[model samples]
Target chain A: MSDLKNNLPVLYSYFRSSCAWRVRLALTFKKVDYEQRYIDLIKNEHKSEEYLKIQPFGLVPAFIDNKSGQTLIESVSILEYLDETYSDFPLLPEDPLERAKVRALVQAIAMDIQPVTNLRILRYVGDDRKDEWARHFLAEGFTALEAMLQKTAKKFAYGDSLTMADIVLVPQIFNGVRFGLDLNAYPIASRLYQELNEIPEFKATHPTKQADCPEELR
Target chain B: MSDLKNNLPVLYSYFRSSCAWRVRLALTFKKVDYEQRYIDLIKNEHKSEEYLKIQPFGLVPAFIDNKSGQTLIESVSILEYLDETYSDFPLLPEDPLERAKVRALVQAIAMDIQPVTNLRILRYVGDDRKDEWARHFLAEGFTALEAMLQKTAKKFAYGDSLTMADIVLVPQIFNGVRFGLDLNAYPIASRLYQELNEIPEFKATHPTKQADCPEELR
Candidate 1:
């Protein structure tokens, strides 16, 4: 484990949740020390009475700032809250137009892609149909995302600096690869993910690196 | 139409889109006079070559700021841009914690609910399945939102002040009613929507008041 600062915030997360991964990446990028509290999602720990009080939706990656007594759910909202609260390494651009672009790009992933392919929803449809549903939805979203990324990308989704869009894209790409989706069709998205995976923060926050992940998954 | 101010921004919108109604509500609350350019979605004006150049997604409620030569898409982004650019009406709260709460509420509606029930996605799935999909998805979202709103609401979604959350909720509830979904299940959401519709700005921005809406629909 990395050396964490004293009295760091606590992050309640599950090993494989993409939404939790987004917050983990943001915390790593911001270099904020946070203690990880693993929620055994397979055991349905998230739906336990204790966990539901922290997050009514029973979603993973509920953040608790001990210093301020603030508990935040919803990954995007948590990211924005962190960015505003810590003003050190700004995740958002100062320019209004650029900020709007970054936000729109992030929303493209958050709103358009991720929710439709979430594991809980996939499981809701049962194993027999899960693969087909995942592929169809992810492919449809990725095609549009690939086109948009090609228009705006320089080094990352919105140019040189790694913004919130890059944070969101990496995990979705991971899920895409796991599902055996065709990466060739989304060359820009694939290339960007290849490049992003090399970064230390992303490497450290990979799902396999999480403490709760079994040795085989690792 | 209501005492126009020369050189104000131009809003590209559809008559009945909830996303478009969001911008309309914001413009009214901010008391900013602007021109409205209607895109006839029924006739496929939004997907027209001319419209695609402005918004690649062919989504309604793109805004063009004549003064700054900036164009913005996505209703939430546009609302944020407007709030930041025109600091008069204060659509978001000054406090970071409150701002986070408001954003979480807005996103619950915009990201979680509206996308699933959007017109374009509905058409993609075909008419036979659209109503079923819309009913199931809206209820899933409304249950969560109703719970959250019950905790945070004073008169609006986040207290007495009219914030962006209220702007998003009113239109979504309007859409819910159009689909004949039962509002009785979400009493808080229904009450808030009823309160919001009584406001002059919201009343003026109603779909029935739009120039292009058919007489039968009106």
Candidate 2:
């Protein structure tokens, strides 16, 4: 990794991490130039004392905006920060009501679905139960999410414009597929995921396409 | 339950639910006059088709803004809507960095800590292991949160005036205590929870103090 200058925002991320992927997509979507510093979760680099100083929670995707001297940890907050700071391509709609709808979809995945099956939780519960636990939670949450998507989806998760909802949705769908979930079970979500996967922002920041991705995955 | 007119934004909530409690506190804090319609999670009322139409996620704390004709699910989104629509006694800080910081703390608890130990997840993992799982995740997450609170707290999770961090912190601390975790282990969080508990807003919105609270708990 190259040493970051005071002018560039550095993102500490792991290629396979869903949380980190959300921020990467946001940065790319907003057309913000950032330095990507890999934190190898497989080797437990995120839990290091030095990294913990950057993110007290010992999680991936901590971002440092050197120009403004702002450091943000959570993916949701980091994405919001990028959207607010860049302002060229707004991730959230201008109307407060529309913004709330987009945010609801983001939290539905970020808060409700993904966290329960996070790597740390899986490790704590034991390796033997990981796949079963993940599949069950992902499917159960997606059942509701599918129903939600049916009501709210247009060209994207919200409407024609790509919003924060679509940004969060893509990585979570990636998680679902990685966990062996049959996307066909949730047809609405499946279709949206397939369509959104073709977008340039989603394509560029995909886990498999990342600079630090494993050779086999890349 | 009173009939909600086209004028009031009715909150679909269950008093015992930590997610619902956050919205309740936010509504009370904002001094928004709204109707409360109980959805008994214990009775599986949230899973009913009628209720599912309102919130496809089958989660409590769905808010319907009759005035705006918007129905929003997810506590964080609802809280943001309340902040934006009401614009009095703002839950989030105006400065983007401070708002991002406050949001990070909210996601720490809402996304990282709370989701792993939600009632649905607890039931899925088996009742025998519920307390063990809840305590383990809560303590681990709080260790990090304690460090965060140490760095950021004063009279509340952020500073003197209450912000989104305190709004999220209180209910999560409530969940921790409910699960039998000793708050004393994290002195900073314990102090804030203790102090915040003494305020009228927190007191009035306490789970046991709610209209839907069971008789014994009440």
Candidate 3:
């Protein structure tokens, strides 16, 4: 029950989707006033015919910038769009080299860590060994993430300022924790995760804070 | 032995690795003068101590820009860096929305299709069911990709011009074909794939053209 004529950006998201959470974080960090339309991923709402029309990929975090009439799908693409279209609190660094570094970290988590452990992938990995699978890959990806963070991190994953690296890192850490991963093994990543969690931008957009989060999970 | 003191950028790559192939395409398309240093993934050379220093993630396609003193990992990030750093034959569209569409298609292949079927993941998936898993996910991801291309495509995945979408599509189609996927199922994607293969930039940087490609495969 939404109108593109409203001129307010609407985000189709699920409370617990990590990909969805990354977009929510970018929007909140950019301080963009937006409306959220919950799409229950568990209910296969994303796979609906109507949803597929809006997002050909049938994924959460399809963003509609009503003013620009740009309906963007894919979290990485949506994030880059938000950063490009909005001026405030840039998600990426200004210099192309620095931006590449930050993006490298983003893909390390987004492509390497999160996608493999996603709900659909987990289901395919089989029920009995899913947790083991998630834990192993999460640990493996994080081992390299920690090494990269050790080389680049200061206050955040990149430098003192927050970039896409931190935006990608925080939610991925949440997933790692969900898989019961031991943070102690990755000291550098563990420290950044703890510090990033304390920031208001990250805290406000946390999965538990979403309207659609179940009472029991909250 | 490669030296950082050399003016030319050194690309650590594997001949058959799709992730590495993406960067090679970007570099070739941009017409940048560079040197290639193969990291044999099958031989576990990527996991070697020296290779770990170059790419802590132990992945191929780690690019070192000697002029900028930037060492970049991740093929997506590397391609963006090449496009941003070298201006000739831009890999992305000038318009922000157009760029997002192109990038969205890139991620649809890079993240959704490529990573799940990567060497490491396939090994973990077990030999018996690995092809089944890869074929299933590839088909699922391609279905969405075909739907997206149907709306936006003309000669390329986005428009008549070459963009990142075509770059991503060419390599993924290579992977899909290697896995015995039927290109006839997705007409739009199939057409783009056929068209992209005709381009010299894509043809020159193809996996089979790499120095490390096996004699029979080449």
Top lDDT model: 3
Model 2, B1-218: lDDT tens digits are: 23457478888989878888888888888888788899998899999999998987788889888766678899999888889888789988878888888898999999989898778888888888888998898888998888777778888798778988888888888877888678889989888888889999999989988898889987
Is 1 or 3 the stronger prediction by lDDT? 3
CAPRI level of candidate 3: high
Q: What is the i-RMS of every prediction?
A: 1.5, 0.9, 0.9
Candidate 1: regions farther than 4 A off: A1-6, A124-130, B1-7, B124-128
- Model 3 alpha-carbon drift over 4 Å, by segment: B1-6
Listed in order, the DockQ scores are 0.52, 0.86, 0.87
TM-score for candidate 1, please give it: 0.91
Question: Model 2: runs farther than 4 Å from truth?
Answer: A1-3, B1-3
Which tens-of-lDDT digit does each residue in A161-214 have in candidate 3?
Answer: 999888888888887788868899998898888888999988999999999999
What's the lDDT for all of these models? Answer: 0.82, 0.86, 0.87
lDDT of 2 by residue, A49-93 (tens): 999888888999899876567678899998887887788889999
Most accurate candidate by DockQ = 3
For model 1, give the TM-score of chain B.
0.95
Clashes of each: 0, 0, 0
Model 2 gets an lDDT of: 0.86
